[model samples]
Target: MSKQLPDLTPIGVVAIAALCTTSLLVGVRSLGALQRWELLVFDWMIRLRPDDPPDPRLLVVGITEDDLSRFGWPLSDRTLAQALNQLQQHDPAAIGLDLYRNLSQPPGYEELVAELNAPNLIGIENDNVDPPPTLPEARIGFNDLVSDPDGPIRRNLMTFEIEGKTRYSFSLRLALHYLQLKGLAPEVSPTGAIVWGKAVFEPLTSTSGGYATIDAKGYQILLNYRAEDRAVETVTLSQVLDRQVPPEWIEDKIIAIGTIAPSIGDVHYTPYSSTSSHPFMAGVVIHAQMLSQLLSAVIDGRPLFWFWSEGVEIAWILAWTVGGAAIAWWCRHPLLLVAVSAGGIGVLVLTTWGIFLAAGWIPFVTPVLGWAIAGSGVVAYRAYQSGRQQQIVMKLLGQSTSPEVADALWSSRDHLLKNGKLPGQKLVATMLFTDLKDFSTISEQMPPEALLEWLNEYLEMLTEVVQEHHGIINKFTGDGIMAAFGVPIARQQPEEIAEDAYNAVSCGLTMSDRLQILNREWQQRGLPVIQMRVGIYTGPIVAGSLGGKERLEYGMIGDSVNIASRLESCEKDRQSSICRVLIARETLTLIREQFVVEHWGPLALKGKHQMVDVYRVLARQQKTGEVPVEPPVDFPQPKR
Candidate 1:
């Protein structure tokens, strides 16, 4: 009959879900800014260079210190012509010169121009207002730099407007050139960005004029770099000029040459940037990434497209919120609850990261925060509630009962206080009423000090007997004690009530014997000894907490109680009145096998409509150091 613990998970979950939803909305509204920051972090973390075998289609021909030392610094056009002529012998698939040829060089400038007119050559171009016209056949595309608002090279300018006409640039332009070389003219949208066939581009909504917002979904770029040198065949300008390396090293290879010197300030700080800056690597590496991307597009048919990761965020948030709440509510052990919550968070984080890597989607962060917050809140609340419940139990049962009974009472208070009615439940009970038989006479014989001390000692011993049998003492009248069994709570069986009565009888007999020794000692001292009479009855009765608000006590008031009190008074009528214990017929019937009893014929009892039969217990049968008392027989035959 203990109080039921309240469940708090559902409430906690609802609160967390609400917080998550709100956080999600806020995140979405700032999607563009979040995406930009995410990109910044990603760009800082992801290594652009390949850790294994290099992609076969991309090559970097470095303009190294070795090349410079071999050919002399800022070599004349004649020397450049010699280098170009040697490069032409290799017949590269495409050649991108990272240096601009806007001004004339030296004697072989025209021959260098003739070499630039080759079909697969691309040149770098600065964002100048005007420039001299160049041969269309040699200039496959232009390379232009695009930076962020803070002037960091974070975006690739695929196309830009010049003189009110859109012109393509950078790696995208090179990809277009490659496509044209393969006889596949890439479809161009009206906006001048190349239309990737069958690839859907859902641009994120933006409020900044016609400028498209860069959400986490809207940009998808890949890179390829080989860890091993010469993974993609490369012939330096010195090698080409000296014919030291094979001509086929560059033949049909997509050759990219650029500065890699740290002093020249040509190196870009990519996510993979390291201390070793071989002067010509920055532009060459970017070109390599672009080339690999283009080859992957053709061979693997992997299209880059935007996916809204918002749904994933919302789903994960709800999952953790519910899961955390469940753990907090269902787990009784504090450690287990904490372990479950932590394990849930770990699983969520791993799942989110895995899905992001596999499907390119980002989950919302607020859901995770919500789950943590809700779980902590629930645990704290549960602890507080548990403490409060314990305090209420202590307040109610602490003082009035024996420690053991108080604990039992507190635990079963729910059942005891059901419907707030007195004598709340039916129970098979034994009622015991004990009166100080000659207490007034003893008090008159003894000094007041001695009388009070003796009474307290007697009552203390008597109360112990009742409590030991799991019986509650209802109250103590001036010179008497009333105790009830199977009450305040109920016993499972009627036999237990009989057992309680027997125990009380045994305790009374022991007390009477012990008092004889005390009386002998007191007689020597010229003081009176006290005597008591006890009555027992067992029957069904209503038992529960009773009394008004401030004076509540667990008690039973019924006909059985009245009969037991009457039986106690009847003790004086017996021939052998020295033994002062009497039991009613009802109690005797339930314990016939236990206690041996002599019958007392039916006697008129006050406040009762009928005469009641009773019995006087004689002795108990002994077995294995324990005495077994049988129930009393029917009242003795009336004398003729």
Candidate 2:
């Protein structure tokens, strides 16, 4: 046997919950909504970082376009040697040569080579690029930058594996050289973050912080960039060679020397490039920024950017998912649910903005996605539930009342039920009772199968006729049907009340006329013919859903219903013939203008104690005052 599947309610709820969980997890693991949001938040945080003034202890000696024009692209060794000789005399703390100079040049090679050996100077290397020709392993530092997929540098590599050996980066080595004068060194933390004094230089991983998937090599950490507008005090290569710069601007400061020429292709896009007024930063300036950031944390006591562990981030996402699920469960209105979802999103945006500013990167996209998945899924499910419930209510009430009544009942179901019970109410309604004239006689004359076939033919006509006039076929009592109008669903307006009475009276006359046509068809088939007697009454009745929880049906249980049934069995009227259609005084009074009911006043029916006034509904009257023998006139349309 095949496995049994659960119904739609449970299935919808489970699907919604599963979607929320899966959407969040997939985002956390793969590159999707969460990753996109992480990148966006990262850009905002970088731009929002506190703008500090340039460090007074650092300086830059750059090769400008003017210098490149004056000395040409590849300056002679004599030019560099003279500039170094001028800078070293100032007694700076340390000097970092940010240029690649491994090749030998003409004229002053021996002099340039001698100046490269200063104890405080750091030479640059690029093993990943074309290897230059100068300096021992201990004297050279790597000068390569790691770019993201978008070609922007946010991480600063501290150490790299070159030729099967770990080598320090140029910026890292330069910062270390300067810090040595103050007697501070790096210590490895248990969590793998680099700690120096009170500062922790935590390196970013592929999944760390706001980065999605990234190249996480070289033991890199987040680069805390300096303010864009604050430029490092620079002197041209021409100024350094001429010895025109003041000694105080260079004395006791760490001076980084590099080329700032536009033709050198040393430019890179930073977080501030798109938003700030300044242009993109040069590669050497980026290095200087890295060095300054590190020294500031250790020497000036500034905080470094860091992130929470994966476990904490998962918990944070799960918490928001629960909140969204709860809101979905409580809110029912569609508009209110939409407003709530928007509010949840706003809270995430503002909260993440503040959190990133203070505590660095957190999981932003996954949490908001969790809210949307769980919340929207539940709301959509509720909407489906309401629709399905309406269909069920329409089918139920449709059996016993007009289409209008069924619709009204569905629209006001919440108001009708009190704690799962349908409350009883007094209603002004028209009750119709229909009985076949000689159904028993016909059943006896025919065989079982043929009898059922004939009975169905007659009942089918009755059902169709009653429903056409918007009258309910409440119950089939062996040979007859019990129906009620303005029941279960109440009529609030006077026009609607009058329309109910008119429909009931009109339906009775139509039933008689259709039965005559059905009899003509039966007579020609060599079968027994049948007729129906219908009674319509208008009065107060207690209408509502009645019975236990396992089974319930709409009902109008009152004296008015009994009187209509009694009229269906009534024997005679004014002509003392078959009473085909009878209308009581209570019903006739409400539909006096629309129906031409013959007054058969004060007939003492068996069930009632007092004498009741009744009438013989021979035919329906049109606006022209003539009673038509065929189909009844259309009832007046009721005011909405």
Which one wins on TM-score?
A: 2
The TM-score, computed over Cα atoms with residue i paired to residue i, of candidate 1 is: 0.62
What range of 10 consecutive residues in model 1 has the weakest lDDT sum?
203-212
User: How accurate locally, in lDDT, is each candidate?
Assistant: 0.58, 0.75
Q: What digit string (tens of lDDT, one per residue) describes model 1 on residues 445-541?
A: 7788877777776677667666665666777877778877655567776566667666666655555555556656766876655556778887777
Error of 2 at 157 (Å): 1.6
Q: lDDT tens string, model 2, 169-216? A: 888888888888889988888998788976887777888876768878
Instruction: Provide the global lDDT of candidate 2 against the true structure.
Output: 0.75
- Off-target runs (Cα >4 Å) in candidate 2 are 1-20, 31-37, 48-50, 128-139, 162-164, 229-249, 273-280, 323-334, 398-640
Candidate 2 residue-wise lDDT at 112: 84
TM-score of each: 0.62, 0.70
Q: Which pairs of residues have clashing backbones in candidate 2?
A: 102-133
